[model samples]
Target: MARLPSGTAIELYESLDSTSLEAKRRAERGVAEPRWIVALAQTAGYGRRGRQWEQSIGDFAGTLLFAPEGASDNLGQLSFIVALALAQSLDEYLHEDQIRLKWPNDVMLNGAKCAGILLENLGQYLAIGIGVNLVNAPKGLAYPTTRLLDFIKDVPTPDSFCARLDHHFWALYRIWRQAGFGEIKERWLERAIGIGTEITVRLPNETLSGIFEGLDDSGALILRSDLGKRMITAGEVFFGPQP
Candidate 1:
């Protein structure tokens, strides 16, 4: 696409099981640099914790594959970077303050989830999958969902949005490569929702309640509980009292 930023190549498809899946296949074969896999619609998209990400025509869903040039431990930190990039893309259509990032990878708009991210470790390359609700919001989801057009009159097409998202992602990727996760952590915390606020995190085995202290340098969620402080590497977080 003409709008795609330089130094990047895109493999556009009308449909796919999942862009992330395609990216993973390519990563297995090997890639010289980061490349994007874009699909107009995904037949089997998924999110963090293996949740299904429903596909719609007007939404943006794409994945980028690239070798991990920095510390291997920082791979999880890409989720924060991807979240920030998605927030920037949303900023183009709505006011900045209206968008808040939920820990791990959900982008909240006006108190509802508008975008989600999924990161996969492919050994040689990292697969970054991002989904933005532009026109169609999945109904009957476990949590509240929203669309970009809900708050804005005009919304860009999936391809157009991916172009913008690519720009933001590349910018942040460069910064992280040159510097580190410190600046990314700072930016992510700025937009992070519910810091210092009490919340509940549901792990696979058990649920924990604690104050959302913030993220550690390595991108783990730091939760302060009655017992002590716990660094959560992965879990489902909900603000306010849980049902």
Candidate 2:
């Protein structure tokens, strides 16, 4: 791969159960800041709520580790920060502004999920994990799925894509660190999927349906329900047909 941005290091793994797990382990073991682990294939990838990520034969999977100074308690904001970076990177290659974020860390395009992010905290460090549907997508998923080749005119190689993403991620991370979550929140809201729309949130014990208000500074989903405005920190969101 070409030279990546400063402060970012890349680690390639032929196969791993989960890049996020590996990165977290390294972070706990005192790995340096801004380390990234890219896996060509993941035998046991996982998504939010421990759901299987469904990595097929050919797909792009990776985890980016960042030991931001004084960021041990800001893991929640970091998750959105990384999602914003991925959305910005995808915007460069696609013409349509269809990239939108689903709550904490899923990226959707035209109502179909094209990518997802998983963040794991390692006390001193944070792992920003990402799994994108590149060459091939899984079968029989609950929702529609997409890949880069479907939107980009000329698809880039996996290495080239990773390099571009690394550059974008670093740029966004810098902005986030300097300006706080205000700017990131605004940008994220711009590409948010169901803001001001109606959606169903699936929680652990019960499901709630409400209007998708927006996200707070700390990256919680602001919902307007029959009871009142509720800040949801974790849940699965589904944009209803009527919004």
Best by TM-score: 1
Q: State the lDDT at 84 in candidate 2.
A: 79
Q: Cα deviation of 210 in candidate 1 (Å)?
A: 1.2
Model 1 worst lDDT run, 10 consecutive residues: 1-10
TM-score for predicted model 1 compared with the true structure: 0.96
After the best TM-score superposition of candidate 1, give how far the Cα of residue 14 lies from its true spot, in angstroms. 0.6
lDDT of 1 by residue, 181-210 (tens): 999999999999999999999999999998
Query: Cα miss at 150, model 2 (Å)?
Result: 2.1
Instruction: Give lDDT per model, in order.
Output: 0.89, 0.78
Worst 10 residues of 2 by lDDT: 1-10
